[model samples]
Target: MLDFAIFAVTFVIILVGAVLYLYPSSRSASGIPGLNPTEEKDGNLQDIVNRGSLHEFLASLHGQFGPVASFWFGGRPVVSLGSVDQLRQHINPNRTTDSFETMLKSLLGYQSGTGGGATEAVMRKKLYESAVNNTLEKNFPMLLKLVEELVGKWQSFPKDQHTPLCAHLLGLAMKAVTQLALGDRFRNDAEVIGFRKNHEAIWSEIGKGYLDGSMEKSSIRKEHYESALAEMETVLMSVAKDRKGQRSQTAFVDTLLQSNLTERQVMEDSMVFTLAGCVITANLCIWAVHFLSTSEEVQEKLHQELEDVLGSEPVSLDKIPQLRYFQQVLNETVRTAKLTPIAARLQENEGKVDQHIIPKETLVIYALGVVLQDADTWSRPYKFDPDRFTEDSARKSFSLLGFSGNQACPELRFAYTVATVVLSTVVRQLKLHQVKGQVVEARSELVSTPKDDTWITVSRRS
Candidate 1:
């Protein structure tokens, strides 16, 4: 077990180094007090395990080491920046890459030819970016279709009690993102079902540093992962083959089919986008509902805005911009939930943050968990007050990092739209109430989520 554990962490470091394109491979971490440019990293699995949950562990580290601290994760140079100011100085550099992509490089590289060099990966990333930009407007209708389906499902449930939203939201997000990303290639429900099964297996392994083959030690999970991955590739290749020379406006795959990336590369990108889109967007919706349930003042404000902007009407894209309060609700949810608890970058050359020297080749993490709730920056930092974002204070920025100005996370922007729509639709129709005695603590996933995450009750407003 010890031998295998060491091997996994070592492999993960190389894997992260290879696929994380934005990170400078050379040594460069600066601007942190007492950080050694040449400090040796300890490679002990027990050390990592002893630390317990990564999110809680990082929070504890911030308490002990101040906002910025250096530590070793199995020989990997890690620097954690717990404050917003630290982020602005170092990670807020325009070129920072989304840390979510690090997990993608390894997980999506499941069998696709990736992590070799940045060339193909870069090109493929561009193509995927193009697909998203090209297809989001075209796909918004598809998104609404899925949203309506979800609403219908919820509407059918008994009105007296709460529904388990986590599982259902996962399905709703999976189906919507799949249809948009894969186009008609995954039209069959079975195909979507199969993809979801594989996705669950793969997603659960993320953020745990992809712990060796033990994650797939279960034969069933291993089987589903491999089979679904192969199916997705076959689907993308077939679509790319047929549509490369054709013109289609509705599907993301159609946009990709026109790209220079090979079918496998396209498939790899599509898979990542699909899986990530599902998890992040679903949780965003969940957290929004969770927050709303806990804050009746915010809920009333949001519902009033939704009713004022879109009363007795179905939610539409044109009206979304007018749903300002709903947007604040979602933003506040992300901020309070710390949906993305951390983001990181690698220093190619020694860098500095706030006059402190950061050593070279260190993983500089933007500890969003700490800053999003900074008492100095936010009035009542722990509260779920969306009104803090009213126009009088709207100009204030950098506090809500959910999907703010950082375009590093493509899916997050997409999720913002999806979540806004969900809030618009749900708040207008039902009043959310917290589940009595339901435990709703934050558990750090790749995206932060409520622990033992269940659902809130809702009743049709009179």
Candidate 2:
């Protein structure tokens, strides 16, 4: 009797599994939407996976499937929306706190039980503003200083030895952002630098582990990540302790410390701020230099713009907006290399785009890289053209892809300020030339960065 009962249970489980496996994912009652029979026949799992790098695979789907396309990413249903009209209709005006908060918790390994309502609200508000205002504003001077340090270092080194543009840019970006987020006291301080280095290594390895599915099974990288986190926390905690009795400064660290929140909240917020700010700016700078070096005409035009506006003076924040063509060059670079190419958000509730229904809990990804390069949207999509972002074009709502509306990166406004300042300063003083036989390929990870070290020779412009 027991053997018969086990056999019946096994049979039911197998039947249920079979049913689930054969179940149609489409919401349509007929288990088939209006997709063309031919197209459906041709669409296969391999084709979906081969669309592009994981970052751009979704946009390729949208390109093939019109404005709305449903696909799977490793068993997870992903919906991609291409049209700005559809995106505006479906994605905007919703609070992203739940998604954003979840990401924060996961990345930093924080428990959800930490903060009260008021504390959480304050932390969120501060984080939002830090993404836009204080972080960027506070970091501008530091960015300038770091650029100067880089220039001095470059000038000191012999031109024959190739300058590792990628590494230097990363270091500079890391320094500037860390200073901005953690305060000047911790920017390059010994303990902070150690923590930053370890954290970067751990996160870099973790990204690899994630792609290879090893993070769960291995403790090596995870251990490093935890160690780095602890060190970072120690640093932040010390800073927070020191600031406990002090008057509030406008720094992000100060803002975080002063908020009526737990110590862990302060540390987690600072860690996110530091990591996010550094990677984006670093990748942007490296790509900007690569593009400027490869295209002499564009570089000349940018240099002329810098000369006309600032005229050999050190580039400053106040002078950034006036550097029109320089700004366009940066915009074009961003378009060419969508730094954060894809953004992922889980649907809070069911949403629809035209005929298709995006069920709740699906991951909705906006593929900025593909959208920015769409042939219909950008003329000569493959060409590097800064003029595409002219004031008129930008004002007319042509999607240039620096930052998306509603889903825009909170830190981009600040990133623009730092990037413009750095680019203008570098171009005004130096002539950048690509190293011989070294072709820079863009690498897409958490951000899009150069695959190999970007080497360039810089000489004082005569």
Candidate 3:
């Protein structure tokens, strides 16, 4: 009996070893002619398991491997590009899908490829129409009202405890975005906040799971995603049902309903629309305020622009375009901080890159954060100089990772408008300052955000 047990144990161990040995590893295909399984970079797997905070690990590899480097994360192959020229190759409009959506589907357990294609198309059309006609024309007044509410709320909070700017910014973004996306039905409602909480919780957890490689195997992530989706569907459907008899407004949900989308598509697409705007806009606001507080020069320049454009009156959408420096500051913020650092895509059919051929259906990631900060493109790449975007030196075809022409996320244009309005309104009224001895750091997820507890002080500018 002992001999038989030993034999079985040895057999299992050998079987596992054989499988690991046969698994294809990631390799640099830059100078090579064809795809071949290459040896894994030492410590690469360990860094991935550490949840993507291993900046030193990735930086070292890129330094050694040149502009294009390949590495493995579990059973997946990741290609990192560190130059604008190479990055542009992957951003060709011919590519139908983006890396962000691919990572999202994988994390959320949705089907990839054509799964979200119809919904994506409808959402894109509605977003374009809304941006061109609805947002600036129809929704600006409501947005201003929402901004006023946020300011009032800030005033209500005790001065000493006013440091929770991150939380307040998130709430403000949610209120404004939801009002525009789903109408005023769920805006500030308890149910809406609850749904946002569930969705955020699941989305955030899945990011952690992906970095740790547990999402692929974790039952907890599966349950969280399922629950969040159900809750989102319920809330959106309820809002839609309530608006059934009413004439459609210019809001996103109204536009979607008027389109040929089915009820499920309406619910899912509406949730994605709202959630995407809230997290990103909120983070941008938080970071902008933090940066302004740290740099008096930037703040002064921005205030000058705002005052010159619309002095002593509330900011409006019509006036946003005239604030050139303010716009430059926002563009620089996105370029320097990299809100959405990584963009990804998958090969539909076999495709060639340089000399090597990528197999059909292989996942490809473009680490936009790395590429955006590439030394070759931007002089003093790590510096936060808004002047880089000024008319004298700004690249005519400047592309940041947030939205590229081919790989652009449709929601980005709206996000830019919302962020511009919110920032302009707040900066015009308040003088923001960072608290002494406090540190603000970025935490990357599906979208990067200031560390959850980031705090700042606000006083009315005299």
Highest lDDT among the candidates is held by which one?
1
> Best by TM-score, which number?
1
Q: What CA root-mean-square deviation does each model show from the true structure?
A: 6.0, 8.7, 8.5
**lDDT by residue for model 1 (1-462), tens:** 000001222335543333322433434333233233332332323443455555566677677778777654534556777776676577444342333544465555543235555566555556666777666778787788778777766766676667777877777788878888767766689978877777776676664535333444467765665676677567656666766776566777777667665667666667667777888889998888777888778878877777688787777767877887777777777778888765555565677777677766556666677777777567898888887776444324443343555344667767878888777777766777887888878767467766675777777767
Instruction: List the candidates' TM-scores in order.
Output: 0.82, 0.80, 0.82
| Candidate 3 residue pairs that clash | 99-344
lDDT of 1: 0.65
lDDT of each residue in 8-37, candidate 3, tens digit only: 111122222322223453354433322233
Candidate 2: where are CA atoms >4 Å away? 1-52, 73-76, 83-85, 93-105, 111-123, 126-132, 135-140, 157-160, 187-189, 247-250, 391-407
Cand. 1 TM to true fold: 0.82
Candidate 3's TM-score reads: 0.82
Off by over 4 Å in 3: 1-22, 25-44, 54-57, 93-106, 110-136, 153-162, 215-221, 348-361, 391-408
Which window of 10 residues has the lowest lDDT sum in candidate 3? 1-10
The models' CA-based lDDT, in order, is 0.65, 0.61, 0.60
Model 1 / residue 462 / CA error / Å: 1.9
Model 2 worst lDDT run, 10 consecutive residues: 1-10
**Residue pairs whose backbone atoms clash in candidate 2:** none
Writing each residue's lDDT as its tens digit, candidate 2 over 149-261 gives: 88778777665767888778877776776677666576556855675686686557434444333454568866876777677678778877776657646467776665566
